[model samples]
Target: MAETGLIQSRYRLIELIGRGGMGEVWRALDESLGRQVAVKRLKPVGPQHDRTFTRVLRERFRREARVAASLQHRGVTVVHDFGEDEGVPYLVMELLDGQNLSQLLEENEQHPLPVEHVVDIAEQVADALGYTHRQGIVHRDLKPANIMRLTDGTVKICDFGIARLGHDIGMSSRLTTTGLAMGTPHYMSPEQISGKEVDHRSDLYSLGCVLYEIATGAPPFDQEDAWAVLVGHRDTPPEPLRTHRAELPGFFDRVVLDLLAKAPDERPADAGDLRRRIVLGRTGEQPALGPGPLARPATGLPPAPRAKALPAWTRSMTAGRPATGSTPPPAGRPDPAAGLTGQWTAATATAPRTGSSVPAGPPAPDLLATLEGRHGAGIDLGRLGRWAEAAEVHREVAAERLRLLGPDHPDTLATRYEVAYTLGRLGRWAEALEIYQDVARARAAVLGADHPDTFVARYEAGISLGRLGRDTEALEVYRSLVEDRTRTAGEADPETLRARHGLGVSLGRLGRWEEALAEAREVCALREHTLGPDHPDTVISRREVAAGLGWLGRWREALVAYRQVAEARTRTLGPGHPQTLAAREDEAHCLERLAQA
Candidate 1:
């Protein structure tokens, strides 16, 4: 067994992050680079298990490493290193900084996610699956716990332990007959449940189950009996999403239902096709009714096939609890630091000595770990929207970090950044603005003027200025930020486009409607090209264009823009969502103005 602390003379395992039937994941440091990484160590099977089972488990671990390392996409986890240490296999990966959907659902007390969030996740997961499917990989086990959403809003699909390459039919066949089902019962597809041939469409069906659960707080089949759940996947039709959550967008409901089609051919043709459907739906450009099986009434599903004995592999399967089944840690318990950056190590806790450029002695590792744990707790509070408590905790941690590691230390600055963020969330814009400026300057000096962290702080400062109605100051901040972002990240980069969008908003606030309209148009076109027309950012830019046109008294043109925004928002975010209603209000106001004109 791999114990805590240094392994392979390079990685120092610090704390356990997660564990499952297969193995345990640890937060560890790469002693070579002084950076943190996650190490997933395969658990050893006892002699009670057949030798073949042990061999298959090791093979799966190696396969996960190979498949994950081969993938290169923003929506997939990045594998850093993999090897065996003392007969124990471990895979090192970039430590993600946010919760998985299962954790997010648990954090929300099992309530359904916001309509917009559900749509966003669906689109992102579809895009990722499209990329993987094109590479001839099928993730046989796509579950909520196997995906992650980072703190920065990037969604990544994780774990390919059970994934299969399309070209490797021989190995796939052997693996399938190992007397174990390859997928979680709750999310398994009909073909997967029946032990039949599976393909990329199976992944789409699994994604449908995930979306259903997050959209309705329960999977399509929520029965406690494993056999019954498999039976439902194999035979029963799922209830429509809106029947459980009335506010789910109609387009979203249709897309998800189509994915849940009983036969593989009845579902969307491929992941690419699925992505296009989501885009079309979000843009309000989809057909009034989808094609093929999607056009059929939900009740028109063919009757269940005649009952037959289920595959023998299913007999050993357990009615596994949903990934979201675990409750949050009790109020006083130490929260698990699963999504933390893992940067608070002794190597990083150096302070500058008085009147010297030489670094001071490193602080105690135990103290650093404790503070890091507290910092994670603060982040969890923020995730729960307890900004007041989060602010207090971050402030305390920032002070301690500053005293121990110096003002410009990354850990100290990180805590301070959270403090500023929570302050902004609490509507203390002035205080937030002050702290953001401080952090920006510090990060620029310590990291670099063009560092991403520095840019983030500067961007937040502009947001603070805008919230305080300092349009001129906000405009200047965004103009400079746009220039820097364009130079560093390129004009087509999302961050650059985001900065330009902010500039356009500031111009409109300053009554420069013509300039605002031009900026918004440019940003909208770039965003559509780079992020697709249905992306939330692109839609926001489109709305900005409408706002600018209205401010310039071009009510006729504004009405067209407003109506498009309203329809898109309605299709993607549901008709009753606050953003959708606001868009509708804008459309109504535009009609009134056009009539007056």
Candidate 2:
């Protein structure tokens, strides 16, 4: 529940403007500054809720404030202040006089926006993205609803809730532990759909989706089913824009299509390049073509990168219904305008009522929503490193889901998967191994042997085997997983290289020094090429190369590798960071070994 008046004794809430699942936005008067502002207040989590979930939510709210407040661009929404009122977090921002693109579409009856308006919005967004990317920020969740058009035609990008700072890999990884892709299904890049590392290029792909929708009155993939939409993004080449709207400029169509390339490398090199191309196209100059749809022979463009499997988590995702003025709310629901900004309605009516009896059949939708929230709370606890508490909550959720959804249900198996991961974190290797194997089998049966989720479980099973000192078994698991990953995701894919790295480690554990060295070198080179030389995964592979060199009695070469890892870690993670210190320790040991020789 939100209060109606003054908060923090400084800002006065005047009227409710927007509401979302997590918070509500109010048109407020900043008494101290004598100005009007939009104040977004987080919905308070009751004491009955998991304390860990409540804490994580507060942290995320604070992060969004910090990230948004740090930016000072005209094409981005400006943050004024942030504070907590009565234990509820709130953020204050500049209020715009016009609606977001989603609302504009709804107002226009879902017709395509004017072509010139579309081009103007694209250029403004590209310029903003260029600034943000240069500042090392990647907006992971970019959609039409998150971009706004002011009354004066100024365009701004909003919502930094899931944005990732380039230097904060550990924080980013922890925040995403809830097993959900951060972006909307229609806008997700192929790499994002397949659970691969995403960079700024992912934002470009999402912008392409936004541009396509505004230009053609629908998303590039307009499928009703969420799975179908995700598959379309992963495998299908979008129909040319001219196919839907004949009046769209050829150069503009080519630009949007190029941004939608399946491979990040095939897209423009950066937002700066994208902006330049847009500028060139607007001025009647031809932009240089790359390997995108525009570079094709005009007969057809190459198909999207074909992955043999999609992540299983996508199966449970919903196709986010686009907002439309024609569709009225059902009886007893609030007006759509009440929930304008977040593009999602509150879950109040969807959760099971307290003190109510559940029927003894299939679980009710309300009960399922409750279970899902609790499951997410469990994940949040794990993200905070409370493994014992996380394990307890996950076990409880897994049992409930199993009873209601059956052993083969994806939800039940997903909960069970979390339970196993927590057990491994708690050092219960044998128990974790058993659960991992079971989940892998169940997922394989349901989602096929080649599904990414099944492969994820199998990969963890290998880690558990290794932790239990069953090196031979771990080696076998990694070898099979590497082959499958290579066949499905391609050899250069990050996941495939990860499996190969595991195989190399297992070989070293079995004292196969020569084979481990070769495998390590190859995987290290590939990781460097695919993930960048200083990425954490590439650094890990480089460390493995050093370990292989040392095991092969190449002390001088090992020393060089160890020193390189140490220097890279120091540069990226800072000299005082634990990982950098560990790298330094490795270098010292290498020197000691060389001295003894």
Candidate 3:
């Protein structure tokens, strides 16, 4: 729209990328940033005179841009800037050097992408969407054209032009006010085509449609007419991928089907977790278990060429880097221990049982990581939760500590402790227990078993055991943990209180009501003193005391405890929430029990 072969000579509008129903993508040089970026522009600013139509069109683009920019994840497209150029609003995003899956499929119609590659891309896309959903955002449209695959093979999701956000856009959707259908018919979830309020799981359903295409080279439901496609998505059963790609991983095929379910609840609860599962499905060649940096070279694929030169101002913004660089820096602080080892005096000697001591030997955790090295974007592709990502990140940190400080370094063990704790968060109880036990043993050997770090790992091991559903085993673990933590951390410490709370939980699970109640009360009081009355953990301990009271047939006291939990959760977490609702429900149950008693 501008005379300078550019829009304001700031965005040198280069060649077009591809045109979609809502917008046209251009491979533009961001003269402001001195880097190449993709500019997605809406189709001719759609009928602005009719306020309602203008509102919907503008609002749609605006909301999508805002929400997309708000989210910062390596798997998601990086939105750099947004503004109006010559009467047309546009979005500036990281100029990814690769083809959209749509283009790849188009280029190779008969041969689908390799299953391993497909899984890798799918995991990244799902993880990105999963993170967005958790933040209360939903990608109303998820399709092949929106997913970008770099030559290095990392997937970046783009085009949130129609994404619905929890925040209010300048323009609101009356069509959406009535809740109308708005996604690609073939990729649309059944509930979405029917005009229902959507959430994160809806994105998962769309992901199923996309994954189905990746696996079989066709959308799950494709028809000659758009209407038929919509209807088919509503009623048709997707053909199983294994029917065509018999070599596909059976578990992954099941996971794809699980995402395609009609109801949101029927799909996986989180995209991050879905991504992790897909990641774990990869062959040995792919690194799917850890912290993911997003710097992979394009797979010998030529990037779409830029038509116009970036302006002098924009060139300055590039920080003098060449226009062709595609490596987006990895998220958070770069883990210093990317590829190195231990500095401790001895290779495997344990530190004393002293609390929090840096052993005289090499840092055991980093030493272990060095022994079993990890790399890549640290994208946690092999599990079903954010815990995978967290665990990997902590492991990476541990590795760096090992490399920088040496094996027996105190900082190294501290990082390893985090790794063990993070593993528990990911719901991998057996593995987490193993790691926790290892760290505890190491801490006890080097720092002394009575050290706070050793006791911490011991307590975590008990929690992990409980998560694994081994109540008797968990009970025994917790009993031991409580004793050790009490002696090492002291009864007044919050961690010691937490150990007591775990003991109470394990006791209750083992049907030892009296002991559970006694331990829980002690935990509640200690936590209140050490961590403050308002701390959520303290409140939870108090709630456990009530549950234990119920187990002992003390309904009145149980009701009191349940009421406190309900009120606290409502205040802290919010009402009508899944957790809050469950708490209130528990309160109701306790009240009913008291009435009966």
Candidate 4:
């Protein structure tokens, strides 16, 4: 049991309520919200595991937690928050007063649950499974212990602890042992037991096992030896429910037996259909239990790219250890940017190109192919926050492109542009400025002076100049780019507004307070009209307006602007986001200035 202490300086631990080999659960108070929550802390892997295993486990944990928290159905347990404290990762969930089905079974001296109770659980579990499956998430682990029944008769599925996106095969394949599986063997589906691709049907198979145990006083395939149980699940057929309990409903037996089908296609098409069968079975209606209407496929956006694993050298500099599992940004500290994206997003305001561009002259195909791989490797390095290593990779790729495609070729310039980006991230402003200017010049010659790519390079040059304390040069770059962008992309275009916003920043840096304030107001207005008030870009412009107000000694107006930005960020990105924290810092600075005045 963990000693009583505060978690993340906010959740005050009251007592350890549950324990497992890999984690412990605590009843805790959310100091910020003044509410009780259940906190589950995953024990850090001991040195017994190699670094590779440890890293994989950590990534799996975080991914599952985030996926669990995003689920909004009532049949699912609520995930309030998740983060790390003192190097131990923890997940904060809604505290529920209920007994899991396993405990309920234990309370009854291992006898099957009452028939009505069994039906209710099956219905609720099926409903929850339906919701999760539609989101393309598979609960890899489903057992009696993971299904909870509240005293109010509400059943919620718990522990999405090992759940993963259906399409995520890379990590799953790595974690699978030769004979052993990720889930409990007795409850595991045949496909899962064989280490084959699993889908929503796997959940159906696991649910079948749970139902079988609760309805028949034991799992359908129970044996004293674990290996025998695995063999029975794979090769032997389960005895019909009537054999164990002659009084059980015939429809219930059919549903459970159908779920235990060896082939995925043989099971009910989805959990929703399974629930319909359970609900209608209680009525006189004939439940459509066999291969009914298939559930709608997952329509959610493709999963975001996983954060690149940190290489050995840069791990120390990447602030605080990466939690073994999903760690929510501490309250009010949302990670709003990817890698150096926050710094370069506005400066390089071009959208990613999805359509393939024909090369100027079919470039050396083999060299181009190799450069493509190297380019991705460089990007992966950057994502890991290894700026130095990323810069090196980009430099090598840029040199190779220069030799094969020439310096003026769009592909070559693109590689050089990435090199400059890494340089800027490393705070080598002077070095970055030279490369940015070179890329801008080359792009202008090849792609036209006012092209979006040309404008993007000039925008970065402006940012580099500003970083070097050369505000006049930076202002010139932004003024020209903003005018060109407004003409080409329209004033309402986000890229144009980005340039206008940069112009405002330059004015503030030059101590042109009045002009900066006006420019900030104008850009903020344009962004609000185009991007909505809650957009990250809009809030960022609003922050600049607050800065201009402070620069002009308008402390009252500055305080209000800063407060608004902070509140907006809290709503959109959560209060603990870095942007929200920055806004709070500005608010504090304004307060200090007001006191002095």
Candidates 3 and 4 compared by TM-score, better number: 4
Cα lDDT tens digits for candidate 2, 238-270: 899999999998989989988987766667788
How well is each residue in 1-597 modelled by candidate 3, as lDDT tens digits?
642268756888778876654467888887877888788876554331233234445665787788888999888888888877766778888888988888899989746788878878887788777777777787767889888899997888887866766553311221110011245667776555543445666788888988889888888876654434653554345678899889988778877987876545546657876776666656423323233221221323211111111111011111111011122223432222332333233332344334433345544565555433332223232222243454556677677765545544444665676566544443345776787788778666655555554565676677666556577987787678667656655788655565666667667656787987888788788878888776777776776677667667786777667667656766877653333444444544453343345
Residue pairs whose backbone atoms clash in candidate 1: none
lDDT of candidate 2 at residue 3, scale 0 to 100? 69
lDDT of model 2 at residue 564? Answer: 78
Give candidate 3's root-mean-square deviation (CA, Å).
Answer: 21.1
Give the lowest summed-lDDT range of ten residues in model 3.
Answer: 313-322
Per-candidate local distance difference test = 0.73, 0.73, 0.61, 0.71
Instruction: Decide which is better by lDDT, 2 or 4.
Output: 2
RMSD of each: 28.7, 26.8, 21.1, 23.2
lDDT of 4 by residue, 448-503 (tens): 67666677788888877866768899899989988888887789987778788778
Model 2 misplacement above 4 A: 170-181, 290-303, 306-309, 312-597
Task: Give candidate 4 misplaced runs (Cα > 4 Å).
Answer: 170-181, 288-597
Q: Number of the top candidate by TM-score?
A: 2
TM-scores of the candidates are 0.50, 0.52, 0.45, 0.48
Model 2 clashes, total count: 0
Output the TM-score of candidate 3.
Answer: 0.45
Ranking by TM-score: 2, 1, 4, 3
